[model samples]
Target: MKTRTITGVFFIIVMLASLLTGHYSFGAFYLLLGLFCQFEFYGLIKKSGYQPNYVAGLINGALIYIAFAYTANTHIVQPVLFLIPVTLSAVFIQELFKKSTTPFQNIAFTILGLMFTVMPFTFFHAMAYVNGDFNFHLPLGFFVMLWSNDTGAYLTGRAFGRTKLFERHSPKKTVEGFFGGLLIAALAGYILSIYYTEIEWKQWISMAILISCFGTLGDLVESMFKRSINVKDSGGILPGHGGLLDRFDGLLIAAPIVYSYLYFMAT
Candidate 1:
């Protein structure tokens, strides 16, 4: 218990500090984080008897993130964006020389790792610069609401959960807990609107709704992935949190959807 609590607190501090420090730190931190998550993902895939091209995946993942971050910061697309497809194509070519029977499966998993782990971080990092400038409010608010939802769901489920939300993927989650999380996330969003006046309260609440719904879906999706492979945790990088991917699974699915929301709202 002590270890979990201490690790959770330390994790929160590092995440908040990275965002609050500056754009450069924020970019660097999440860039590394995204890579780590991708690495963990590839590790899990390997355990399931599949081989994802770690080198190509990580290299292209870095390139994709850096390209997005650069575009987000400068509001100008760079030539490096063109290098992604070119580099990614090399994965398929590289697999041709390998003796693996599941070459296409390897290729697919490699691409899936990029889409699942890398692209979301790219969208999330872009969130800080969504408004033609670097402002941490939206991204910060996102974490706040996401954490709120997770806490609310857990507490409410433990106290009064009677019905399962998704028995196949997650047995512990409850319908009642889902509503509990929605309420808490909405409140968090409302509170964020009070301080971060860049977006109105309704918009914040709507974002909270999106987070609650999609974040839960993301958790279930990750759970399904683990169940498919018959594993318990993604990794043990954190003492209590299991892995970086385990901690950020919600962000993986929610970030892109929320980014689209913020992007459309801004435009």
Candidate 2:
């Protein structure tokens, strides 16, 4: 327990520092994290007895992060978005080099892993790229909101949880705790909204609810994968939390969705 808490704090500090200083440092930090997560994902898939192209998976994950970073800094849409199909074609062509039992299956797994693990990180870039007039606190707001929802749900669920949120995927989650998480997130949103006059009340509430709901779903999704793999945690890199992937799964899911909402619904 002590180890987990300490490691979690260290990870949070790293994240806060990187996010607070948005530019090349932030982009590089996120890129590194994406690489770590992609490596872990590739390792997990390999354990399933199929030989996914590890290099291809890393390249794909890096491409996704590149798209995200470029989009955040300016109007430049990453050409990698268009290059995915071309890249996949190359992966297919390379499969002929190896006489594997199931080459197509391996390639499919690699693509699915990219979608599951790398795709959602686009939200981080989107959050970094809010309108120029906004203050430095814009990105911090995202971290606070997400952390509040997670903390609120965990504490609330432990204290007064009864009904399960998703028993099969996440047995420990309770519907009561889920609402508690939402309520706390909404309260945090309302307070933060006052600072950012550009965002309306509805938008704040929407962000809060989306984080609580989808963030919980993200947790469940990871749990499902872990359960299928018959593992308690994704990796042992972190003491209490599990791994980098475990810690960031909710953020990965929530960030992109919230960013999308803010982008499309803006006046």
CA lDDT, every model vs. true structure: 0.94, 0.77
lDDT per residue (tens digit) for residues 1-267 in model 1:
999999999999999999999999999999999999999999999999999999999999999999989989999988999998899999999998999999999999999999999999999999888777899999999999999999999999999899999999999999999999999999999999999988789999999999999999999999999999999999999997799889999999999999999899744
Off by over 4 Å in 1: none
TM-score, one value per model: 0.99, 0.91
Cα lDDT of model 2 by residue, 100-154, tens digit: 9999988887787777777666566556667643234556776677788888888
Which clashing pairs does model 1 show?
Answer: none
Collision pairs in model 2: 4-240
Can you give the lDDT of residue 48 in candidate 2?
71
lDDT of 2: 0.77
